[model samples]
Target chain A: SQTIHQWPATLVQPVGSPLSLECTVEGTSNPNLYWYRQAAGRGLQLLFYSVGIGQISSEVPQNLSASRPQDRQFILSSKKLLLSDSGFYLCAWSRGGRAEAFFGQGTRLTVV
Target chain B: QKEVEQDPGPLSVPEGAIVSLNCTYSNSAFQYFMWYRQYSRKGPELLMYTYSSGNKEDGRFTAQVDKSSKYISLFIRDSQPSDSATYLCAAPSSSGSARQLTFGSGTQLTVLP
Candidate 1:
């Protein structure tokens, strides 16, 4: 069975601080990885996706970036966080050519 | 118009009542349709997935897709308090460039005891 693991279930960071969120998947190879943010009273927005190692596609241009260091390890980072960056972050993985993706527990970040 | 439109209703219904949640899309190229349930602060969980048009049922949940009308529905039979959550409708991106899934705003359902 395939499973996704994400860290820092909840985070509280000050403005202009650096941020790092990690996601790792097991039981799959060359899987598609995605990062999504869900704002209050809004739909989940796609932030970044990776097709393979060292390849990242960003949907929304913001203060955040994603990197695929390994086949199953994905990282979302930000040099300086903004107040608007506060939201629930989710990590998901799917097989190539598949539409359904599995999600991780998610990280709730609050910027003050 | 947004690609997918769903009513963000804090719909409150009595237990055992049948709940109907719906979403409409403007994209005809969307070939895959799915329903996901998200608890208060947890990640969304896949509830149902369907392709093309027709109905697919699992246990007490039934998913219906009408491609001609560009509408999809999720029906919950004998709803319970455990079913209280947000239901979101999703489909793969039609743009072919990225495999990201587009989502509806989501409908919040509350099953009252």
Candidate 2:
């Protein structure tokens, strides 16, 4: 079975501070990875998605960026955090084409 | 207008009652549809998935997709308190290349014991 692991399940970062959230998938290779920010009543907004290593697509322009360093390792980062950047961040993986996506536990980030 | 739309409902129901959740989309090109459940402060969990139209059932959950109407629905029979959560409907990107998904605002359901 495949499992996704996200670190720092909860984080409290101050404004203008750097942010780094990691997500790694085990038991799957070359999977499509995605980063989404979920806000209350706004649904899950796709921030970035990667089909392969070193390839990332931004769905919404903001203060966040994503990277795929390895086949199953994805990272979401920001040089400086903003108050609006606070939300429930989720990491998901799917097969190459269209398929059911599996999500991680998520990281609750609060930018003060 | 948004590609997908769902009622942001905080619906309350009694235990053992039937629960119905719904979503509507404006994009006809969307071919795949899905439903996800999310607990407080957690990630959305894929509950049911259907392609195109028709109905698909899994245990106590039934998923219905009406391509003609561009609407999808999820029904939960014999609902329990454990089933209380936010339900989100998702559709595939029209482009189909990235397999991206556009999600609904989600409906919050609470089953009282």
Question: Which CAPRI tier for candidate 2?
Answer: medium
**How many residue pairs in model 1 have overlapping backbones?**
0
Candidate 1 lDDT over A1-104, as tens digits, reads 88999999999999999999999999999999999999877899999998899989888999999999999999999999999999999999988888898899
TM-score of each: 0.98, 0.97
Q: Which residue window of length 10 is worst by lDDT in model 1 chain B?
A: B93-102
The TM-score of candidate 1 is 0.98
Each candidate's interface RMSD (Å, one decimal) is 1.5, 1.1
Off by over 4 Å in 1: B94-98
Error at B97, model 2, angstroms:
3.9
Off by over 4 Å in 2: B94-96
Instruction: List A-chain TM-scores for all predictions.
Output: 0.98, 0.98
